[model samples]
Target: MKAYAVLVPGLAASAPADADVRAFTETYEYSTQPEGTTSVQLWHTARRVTWDEDYAEEFEHRIEIKHGVSEHWDVATSTVLVQSGRNGLTLDRVVLGPRYRFADRAEWPVDVTLALEAGKVADRSIYPLELRVVAARDIDSLTLAANGIVGVQVGADVIDEVDLAIGWAAGASYQLHNKLRIGAETWGGTADEGPRPPTDGVNASVGPVVHVAPSSKLWVTGTAGFGLTDNADVVAV
Candidate 1:
């Protein structure tokens, strides 16, 4: 589940305009808030896993605050809370990131954005760094987007070498009404101590998604994802 709330008015003060069209729950689009505007987003995710004869559940809650510094640049920070099995909910990590768009919509064949983020996890010496290339294209009422992601784990604790991960996310959505859009998305990734084949230690999922904007100030999005590999969770929402 995902919810977006606009706290400040900018170029437009209406639904679908006030907030970017969030077509996929896991994939991000190439749109930024107008300069001087601010927005808040809340996200919740649940996963179920089975190991031997035991079943465990995990929950994650995230809150993000974003501010636009210019037409093409924006910065955001996120706090994550996590709960696993019978453990109590606790702070897990905090991440800070900045995103910059290369050109305005329709200025090029596809709009592109560069995003970089750093995160610190609780009680862990290893820190996480991520870089993503976001690309999207709009054709009438239909939109297509994709993201290429790379991540690294660095810290004093790493013995031999740092860990590396790579992934990709893609989605397509079509506006059915002024306040509603329907879409589908797929994402997968693999990680190890260094570069390796994509089939190694890989997990993947595919899902259908929906976005609804009931009012000018609020927007909601949801997705039902199913695992495609044995290493992935059975289902996620």
Candidate 2:
């Protein structure tokens, strides 16, 4: 028997601050990384195609923030949480205000996000303002997901619309040891245009997730993958 190197990214999903992005062409769907720090990650996969090993690779770096603590309330009568703060949910950052959790939890867990486009990184490209409305449901062995986003470029009239970024990924994980698990997972996403659609693009990934929980509050993860099609990137920049 032979042992192989397995990737381990611990229980980061439990409290990842900015973990929902399935609702647009620009946001990422799911990541096992936690909030309040930055991480650079790379992944690759090799497949035996035509008796030869073909390979694909991807890499990405992300900065995440879990800014505030939210209080949840229950309102069974009207089915809405009484506003405890000023934030409300909308795709345009249409409004930048506090949001209150309904007294009772909605059928799904919800998070509202607003990307302030107050500055530009470059002179040629104007970073657009994006608003995200995301909801997710997780069960014992399966997870459910859906999201919607509205993107607006400051000066570009060509980009503005109510777009739903929707997709799902599922797999049952098995622990092979006290600190390692092996399993296959996959997800797909597309930008469905509303009246004004964002730039058209497709994002999806399929491979394995190495799950580990090292201590009470620390875990690390790595994902390696190969694109099923040549159209996918050798390195997703």
Q: List model 1 lDDT by residue over 61-111, tens digit each.
A: 999888778888989899999997789999998999999999988899999
lDDT of 2 by residue, 7-52 (tens): 2234233444333212112222322223322222222222221222
TM-score per candidate, chains pooled: 0.89, 0.41
Clashing pairs in 1: none
Judging by lDDT against the true structure, name the best candidate.
Answer: 1
Cα deviation at 186, candidate 2, in Å, is 3.5
Please identify model 1 stretches exceeding 4 Å from their true place: 8-18, 51-53, 192-199
Q: Point out the worst 10-residue segment of candidate 2 by lDDT.
A: 73-82
